[model samples]
Structures are given as C-alpha cells and as structure tokens.
Target: MGNQLHASAIRWLSHVPFPTTLVWLPETVGADEEALLLAAPFLGESPDGLSLCRDPLGKPYPARRGYPVPWLHISNTHDGGQRLLLAAKHENLVGVGLDVVHLPRLRSPHKDRAYLHRLAARFMEPTEYERFQCAARQDDEEALRRRVAAHFSLMEAASKALGTGLKVGAFMGHSASLPLSALGALQLEPSVQLFFDDHAQTRLATLNAQRWEAYWGSDDTYLVSAVFLFDNEQINKLPLDEQTPFMSY
Candidate 1:
C-alpha cells in the first residue's frame, strides 16, 4: 500500500505544468546519503560531487562537492518521518515546495466528527475557518475530511515554497502576506492557483516578480500538494547563468 501510494504521488506530480523532478528518501537520511541516492545513474554519475545544503533561512538546495549548485532548486517535506518528499526543479523555477499527509491518520480513532475542523484552527485564520465552515456544511463526512486534509497540505506546501515553513508571519504579515485568504475559497477540486497579494508581489519584484500556484491530488491513503514560485511573465524561466542535467519526473 505504501509503495503504491508513493508511486501514485510521483505519477500525479509528473503532471504539474513545470519542469520538475521528484524522489523519495528516508526521512532520517543525511546529506551525503541523499546525494548518493540522487547520483544513481538515472540522475548522474558524480556521486561524490553531489550533496545538499541550506541557506540562511534553512531552505535546502542541491549542491556539488560542498558548493551550491546554482541551477537547482529543491524543497522537501515529510509526514512525521515516515518518508521524505523531495522535489527538484531547475533554476528556471524560482522555487518548488511539496507536502504530503496521510488521510487515514487524520481520522481520530475516537471518531470525532469535528476533529478536522478543530485541528485546522491551529493554522487557519478566523475568516478562513468561516469560509471552510460554509463550504464544509454541504459536504458529507468523507468529503469534509478530504477538504480538511487538503487545507493542511495546501497551506503547508505554499509556506514551504515561500521558504518559510508554516511561520505565522508568512501567512499574515505587515509587509508581505501570501494570498492565504484565497485558499479558503477553494473547492479543492483538482488544482488551483493561489495568488500572492500585492505585498508579496512587491517583495518578490526583484525575482522578476512571481505568482504562486498549487496543485493537489489524493488517493485513499495519501494526499499530496505541490507549490511553485515561477516567473509571472515567462513562468519557467529564471536568471541563472548555468543549468544542470537533472532528471525529471
């Protein structure tokens, strides 16, 4: 079941409208081990030359021989050390973030109907919760559960893409707030765009400006969400000077 779900996630992720690659690694694996895994013939031959590193904000990026690989962007998420969800894109993409959660795990063993709603409160704003309530009222118990799962994955995915992992200020800040308010309105259909607010645009102006979009899907077991920070004008082009021959999903 776990292998099937993992394959399903990779297959679903391949359809994302960007040049991206994804792989799964053990959650507790170190950078050297991760580099070696990625260095398999499918990716490249330079095992010793590949590794991972973090920036000042702790965003991981692909590196080579201890030096940052300028053309690779990477982001990762996991569900409590069960497995690592690693996503990579070329420098042509500003950023890429991914998150996955197990849906069955969300159901409280005690059968608490309001479990999802209550859990959302920890991260959702008041207005967001209000909108969720309005939409959730029309959903059956199962649908309501999926919506709540999507809620968690989408928000966390977007936060990771922004290089801030669920920080309070990333969702609602004085200078630049993500368009988190837009998420509340989503029906969690198949995929949707989560626009950034004016503050975000102004702040990201230097990266030739960007727009955020999230794509999500689920199986009976796992829900996966991916966030991309891409150029608004070109969508898949970045200002990097070099490129890497990384494999894609």
Candidate 2:
C-alpha cells in the first residue's frame, strides 16, 4: 500500500489521450485467464498477456509483477465466489471503482426484506429507507430488488472511486454524522447522477438487457455499476473494445 508505483502501468501514459476501459472476469484460484483474453483486445499487437502486480494499497495494475503503474487505478469485488477485475487509467485522474451483483438471487431466501431492511437501517438515511420501502412495495418484487441492489452497487463503486469508501465527505458536510461506509449510511441526496458530467460515465447498467448484449455477448443475470472520476479534457469514456499505444507523458 505504499505509494511507490509500478512502471508498466506508467507506459500507458503519453501526451495523447487514452480512453478509460474496464473488463470483468470470474475469479480463479490460479491466474485469471478470462481477464487476460479481454485485455488482449486492449493491449494491441504482441502483448505479453497482461501480467499484474499489486501496490501496497493492494490495488492490482496490469504490469510486470513488482513495478506498479502510477496511472492505473483498480478496484474489484467478489460475488458468489466469482471475482471481478476492474482497471481504469487516465492522465492524472482521481480514482475509479467497480462493482457487480447477481440479480436473480433477489428472490433467494437469504435476501429477504427483513435482512435488506436491517441492512438499510444501518447504512441508509431515513429518506433512503422510505424510498426502499416504496420500491419494495412493487408487485414485481424481483425487479424492485434488482433496482435497489443496483443502486447499492453503484454507491459502493462511487464510494471507492472517491477514495472514501465509507467516510465523511466534503459534499456530505455535517448531515452525515457517521462515516457513510455502510449502504444505509449513504446520503444519496440530490443523487448519484450529480457526480458525473454525463450518464454513461457512471451507470446502473442493465446486465440482461439488449443494449449491452453486444458488449457482454449475451443476456446474463447480473448488474454492473461503475464510477469513473476523471477530467473531461484528460480522458474520454472508453468503448468496449479499444487499443491505445503507450507514449511518454
């Protein structure tokens, strides 16, 4: 977790712009091959297959094992034994975060309303709790649960991208008395949209929807939420498949 950075990640930085991109792979006990395949599309020409190294912060960066990249910001989450790998690189950008959750499981006994309600009370503001109740009241219980789960996932990503993951922020000021680390504690006032200049930059994207079918290959039962923090002039939202050469900054 010391700030000393790796070199390969730095190689991606140059005077020209490099779009911020992300990839997700199921977790593996050994090396994660699925992530490597996705990376091939982005690395262009003879990539040594996407080696990774972790910094003192335990952040993974695509680089030779020991040298950490200074520009790449990474965050990941685990769901049902599956691992998600998210990496974002921008010229002097702040941070990036990613989260994934399975949708169909909302109907599972484990995620009953009582559990969700308790979790909401611990981390949500009163308004947030009320909103959840309203959402949960819908006859389409599964869809409602999915929406709530997606919202929570996005907030988690945003919290990580902000480098506060669950802490008091200047935006929250005094109203958020406790560190907003838990889902219920988040004061998602004016809204999560305000954090981004555009909609796609941060999204509660549908996983089993047609819009993303091309990107993911087919409809799957899940939702992905990501938060990207960058200076507009410094980077553009990366498309699903893109390749940029490394150059000097």
Candidate 3:
C-alpha cells in the first residue's frame, strides 16, 4: 500500500495517492461495530470482519471472523465519558488505533486542575504547554478548551499510529504550540506528525508519518480512527494513485 490521506466524507476525493484510507463518521452513524460492518466491504472484506468487538477499556468481545487489516476505532463521549478501541491482523501484518472525546464548552474549575494537569502533562508537547499557559493567563476559556482538545486529539492520533493504543505513556509528554509549525517539530515516539483544525463547534486532529495515518474528530459527537499498511517501506515505493491493494475494491 502507498502512503496517503483521504477525506471519506468529502464529495470529491483528494488527488494525493496513498495506500491508506480514512473513514469519517457523522454523529448519526453507529458505533465501531456498525461502522466497521459498513466499511469492511469497501475494503473487500466480509461483513464478518466487524463481528469482533472490544470495549473502550480494552476488553475483547466476540468477532465473527478476525479482520485481515489493522483498524482504529473511535466514538464520541457522552455525559459520562468516552471510549477508544483498536484491532489488527497479525497474519496480514496490519495495525490500527483510535480515540474520541466531546469538545468542552466551558473550562472546569481549579478543583479539576489536578486531573487536567495530569492529562496535559501526559499528552502535550512543550510548545503546547506554553500555549495553554498563555491562554490560561489571559483567562481565555475558549482558547484553553480548544488547545486542550487539540493536544489530546493529536496524542490520541499518535498513539493509534504507533499501534500502542494508550498502553504507552509518552502521550502526556507532549503539548500544543502557538504557531502550528511547532507541532511538526515535536519528537514523538513512532515518529508521528500531528495536524489539527479547531473551531467553535469542532476540533479535529490527525497524525501522519511514514506508512501510517491516524485521526481524531471531536464535537457534540466526536470520533477517531487510524489505518496502517503492513509493509511500511512498500508504501513509499508506489505512486499515490497506485498505492493500496484496495484500489480495485
């Protein structure tokens, strides 16, 4: 497969060629299982591939037949909390990761500082921390919320691309910066890159590096998903248009 990114929700596909495909689901779409069932056929896999299910806590559920490709699953958070799921095929050598969260409308009180700080320390880069600090100093609630959302989302994307789920602890080690360029320089494990766009209603982040690409989208209904090719080097050798085995599918 070749390395590229596509907007699954767009009417016109991008010209960039890559072996990977990104599927974005609206709030109306079902959870991971349902989304996978709909997406499997497009990748030339059977509906049974969606049978395997796992909870956000990483507990494995039943699957009809194990998938032959890597998959990253994401869903939005409700009033309680959110869930992220991942699955992959060892035989075919593919891996996937995913994450999701609801965008915060208001900043929490200082009483919630401990929790937020811990999360920031875990997933934010130094530049991101600076930006957050600056936003906090100005008492800009909206800016703070957006930065936090962007930081977490990017980390989530990186985690998925690395195929570590959240098992790895480096996520909290990074932060967001004022100038977006600072983001490209952060040294993250798995050598991932973070991309984001934040507005009043939504915050989206994606990580693309080498043969892998991971993404996170948060709003009233948020989601994250990632796709990775088995042979990392093979993707670079092929042209973008001719990239994945699924092109014909």
Top candidate when judged by TM-score against the true structure? 1
lDDT of 3 by residue, 1-249 (tens): 122122231111232243333333333434545544544554345765456455443423335556323433222222224222333332222434444445443355652545565666555556656555554564344444544554565555444433333433444322221222222213222333443224200211222222444433333333233333343434433364652221110
Q: What root-mean-square deviation over C-alphas does model 2 reach?
A: 12.1
lDDT of 1 at 57: 61
Instruction: Kindly give the stretch of ten consecutive residues in candidate 1 with the minimal lDDT sum.
Output: 240-249
Error of 3 at 30 (Å): 9.0
lDDT of 3 at 241: 62
CA lDDT of each prediction against the hidden true structure: 0.59, 0.46, 0.38
Global CA lDDT of candidate 1, please?
0.59
Candidate 1 vs candidate 2: the TM-score winner is 1
lDDT tens digits by residue: candidate 1, 116-228: 67766755657667667887888887778878877778777766666645335444533333444423224455456454445445535645535666777766777777777
lDDT of 2: 0.46
Q: Which order, best to worst by lDDT?
A: 1, 2, 3
Query: Comparing candidate 2 with candidate 3, which one achieves the higher lDDT?
Result: 2
Error of 3 at 210 (Å): 5.5
